[model samples]
Target: MGEVLQKRFPDMVALFTGLGFLTVLAELVLMDHREGIRILAPLAAGLGAGAILLGLGFPRGRVWATGLLLLVGGMGLLGLVEHMQEALEASSPSVVRLVDEEGWEYPAYPGPLREGEKEGSPPPLAPLALSGLGLLGALALHARKP
Candidate 1:
């Protein structure tokens, strides 16, 4: 089943990988020198679709697994965009200035999905991080038979 799934859903894997890479690179390309905003909504959609493909267990919990995986992966993409932006900003060339720009509307999307950062460490991206987990999980269950 896993092998069948892998063959049938190659695009799903590709989509997941692409979303992961693009979201990470968004800050490098679009917004500020902090630097950019790449189109991420489509990527989010892709991940959701990939998740559904992944959680499609053979005869056991196939439907429910597919649905939940889809939901988790889809939501992860949105969260990644929001969380990645915050991370990139903190890791930006002007990290200090950007961080100090008081009352700023984040100038992008929401800031960090989790609370706190290192004294100087770039912000942690738990949300963005989860997307990878989803990807790996999907990949791992590429062709689950049962």
Candidate 2:
């Protein structure tokens, strides 16, 4: 039973990491439709998928795992930093004014969505956190092997 579990560990990790990456990609795509945003989602998804494929195809190779972990981890870390910064900025009190095409002026709510105020959504930190955790797990697993 222990041998069986040990043998399946890498496959399970690869599957989960792949799914996590894909989920993050989907979240990024759904959150925004801008071209700039689209670019990152595809890139992240591709890299993540590639990592999974590499893991499955070359289970004995440490290099692929290391490279994939580094890429995904770095991206996730960057996302975490970016989101934290955004969250901090959102928490601050600020007033914003906007003028419409017809020259109508309106006051915009500052920061993330507040209670009973439903116009804008808050920045997504969940994905960043998940990705970061996944990356850390992968790194730890890698370190523990041999």
Candidate 3:
């Protein structure tokens, strides 16, 4: 198994990168974009695509691919930090009013809103997936026998 993986590492990396890119793109589209950070949605998608292309050997160079992968990884780390900060800042305790089916209204205390549940936020851990994939590709490229 180890030998097989070592020999087919590039193909595996390419396949996983393409799948991850598609998944991220679909998720971004589904999550929709806020006016403030709308540009970031497309930017992330573009970067993911570029990484996929590099992983798939489209341009055929390890150094270029490694650089792009590292860049993507860094962006993911930045995003994770931003998301955690936003979540922390918005986590003050609060009471929300709820209306029941019987048309009765009551004050309900709820836990802090999660990452993407808040307005204009992305999932807290979503960026980590990008980071992991990027780092994995970079490391795989570096480790593969030339």
lDDT of 3 by residue, 1-146 (tens): 99998788776776677578677767767766435644464466567667666655654676787777778788778778877877777665456899999999998877666775654444678778778877877776676555
Compose the digit string of candidate 2's lDDT tens values, residues 78-99. 6667657756765765669899
Q: Residue 55 in candidate 3 has what lDDT?
A: 52
**lDDT (C-alpha, whole model) for all candidates:** 0.49, 0.61, 0.70
Ordered list by lDDT, greatest first: 3, 2, 1
TM-score of each candidate?
A: 0.34, 0.61, 0.67
Query: Worst lDDT window (10 residues) for model 1?
Result: 31-40
State the lDDT at 75 in candidate 2.
68
Residue pairs with clashing backbones, model 3: none
Candidate scoring better on lDDT of 1 and 2: 2
lDDT, candidate 1, 1-146, per-residue tens = 99877665644554554466455445433532231332443344345445445455344544554454445565566666676666776666333323445655434454554563343433355455546645554553445445
Instruction: Report the alpha-carbon TM-score of model 3 versus the true structure.
Output: 0.67
- Could you tell me the TM-score of candidate 1? 0.34
Q: Residue 99 in candidate 2 has what lDDT?
A: 95
Model 2 gets an lDDT of 0.61
Model 2 shows how many backbone clashes?
0
Per-prediction tally of clashes: 10, 0, 0
